[model samples]
Target: MKVLALKFENYRNLDDAIITPCDGVNVIYGDNAQGKTNLLEAFWMFCGGHSFRGSKDNELIGFGKPFAKLEVRFFGQDREQTASIKFKGNKKQVEINSVAKNSAAALIEKYCAVVFSPEHLNLIKRGPSERRKFIDSAICREKLKNAVVLSKYNRTLNQRNSLLKDIYRHPELEETLSIWDNSLLLNGAILIKQRMEYLQMLEKRAAEYHFGISGGKEQLEIRYLSTTNAEYGDSIEQIHQKLYETFEQSRADDIRNGCTTKGAHRDDAEILINGKNARLYASQGQQRSAVLSLKLAEAAVLSERMGEKPIILLDDVMSELDSKRQDFLLNKLDDCQVFITCCEQSNKEQLKHGKIFNVCNGVIS
Candidate 1:
């Protein structure tokens, strides 16, 4: 998939502008806080709903502006397509090919892209939630229904937690807890099954990429460590049974803690480098490379599943990498459309084939 053109209005600090990017590498370079990353964020808006930077819908609008509008024309599914997003107040609307859609997630089926920001290195340097997010987001791209499943799971988990707090206070409301438990069991089991399936594919691909990145000197491994103690290859029914028994055993502890303790939300994936925890043992460079491997593997998996390469967005990540890794990103990834953001103009000379756009104070020229 490739972005043909992009138009923005009252979006973040960007001036109203339209960008026509090259089919290959497109570099957005400027000084810090000049809207280079905002340009990439505009491209990413087409991929899913919310900002990869975790900005709220209202936050996407420029100060003193009443609304924000983003539109893009892209080549996908054997033809050129157009999509747009409009944000007003706290509400946003989405449209594809001029057909109105209920939400921004509808764009996932229309456009697919993987992003790597500097914060993504936290996948290896931080705790398990980061890794869980990486897995879950990839799964959602591959299957849109998984997004609904994930949303429902979180909703049910919240309701159950609220009920847990009530049970602590009233003691008589404890009977109603089983209602949420059944919903949580079913949804959490399905989620655990889907996560394991995606992780199995990701683990192999990520390990292969990591090996190439490490010059075949180090080994990388990823395994799902379940909060419900569900084993790999367990059927949904088996998972549900295990979780049900666990919930029954943990009800007292959960009420005392005022939270749902044993479910998919509490699960984590263990990432290992050479049989050691990546979060604890991997060096800074190693962690970046590991995260890079996961991201590239995500792109590759999307390509295999979607039958087309997904666009890659690299936001201010090149400076953290060494020359070898930089070469791999700049010269090796020739098959996919890439939008890279950098603060240094010298980085432009490193590209073999691409167009460069300069941004200064929210203006792209």
Candidate 2:
């Protein structure tokens, strides 16, 4: 999809203004802390996700302002649509096409975007939770129903943990743990199956991208690490059986620990660069390249599943890349709408064709 216009009032550090972007590449350049990334964040909010920078609702409003308002008009699915968000005192309201929405997440079905911020480097630099979130988010975007399954999984996990804590004090209540375990087993198996399938598709596309970014000298591999010992080709039934056994095996330990110690929530994925774990051995550049590859692959997957390309947002991640890598991002992403934030004026000159918006102290021109 493409963003035709973004209107902002009392949002972050931005002055009240409307921005019209080109259909292809749009370069937003400015010095650090001048609201360059804020523009992209405004566009991303329409996708029904929290800020890429992890800002809270109250933090999104400009200082001395009581509220913030943002609106976007975009072309997608053979039509143009409008959406608006209003934030006041840590609460927000959303509307799409003049119809009120119960929550901002309702916009996910109407808009799509994939963002790559420097913070996303956590996918490799941090623990397994970050990697799991990356895979889960992509799956949710591809299949909205999976989002419900994921929510159920987390809820079941929390309930199970709470029961485990209570079981420590009252042995009679231990029987109810079985109920939560059954729900957890079913939901966890579904999650494992979906994650395995998504990673299989993602690894192929990411490998190709990593190959190009690394000049074909490095090979990228992604392997799912299921806590239930479920392999990549395991059927859903097989996965469910394994999860059942795992829950049985970990029951005592879970009760003693007062939380779950196994299942999908505890699983992870390994990112290998030429047979070595990127998290442990890859250089900063390699890690960044791997993240970029995975993000672009995510966009590719979304395009295939959605039948239309999702908008790409790149936030201040170019200076660390070499010319070859830079060329790939600037010239290789064809038929996709991209918004890139950079501090250097040279980045704008690198774009052969596109619109450029300069930001200075919250003003865009």
Which regions in candidate 1 have their CA more than 4 angstroms from the true location? 61-68, 88-93, 100-102, 169-176
**Highest lDDT scorer:** 2
The TM-score values for the models, in the order shown, are 0.88, 0.94
- For 1-365, candidate 1 gives per-residue lDDT tens digits of 88999999999999999999998888888999898888899999887778999888999999999999999999999999999999998898999999999988789889988999998988877787887888888887777688888999999999999989988999999989988888899988999999998888888988987887776777888889998889889999999999999999999999999998888988899888999998898888788878888888889888998887899998986775666666667666788898888876558778888889999999999
Write one digit per residue (lDDT tens) for candidate 2, span 1-365.
89999999999999999989998888899999899998899999988847877789999999999999999999988899999999998898999999999999888889999999999999999999999999998898777789999999999899989888998999789888888888888989999999999999999999999998878889999999988899989999999999999988988999999999999999999999999999999998999999999998998899898887899999987877877777677766768899889887667778877888999999999
Error of 2 at 308 (Å): 2.4
What would the TM-score be for candidate 2 when compared with the true structure? 0.94
lDDT of 2: 0.90
lDDT of 2 at 337: 92
Error of 1 at 243 (Å): 1.6
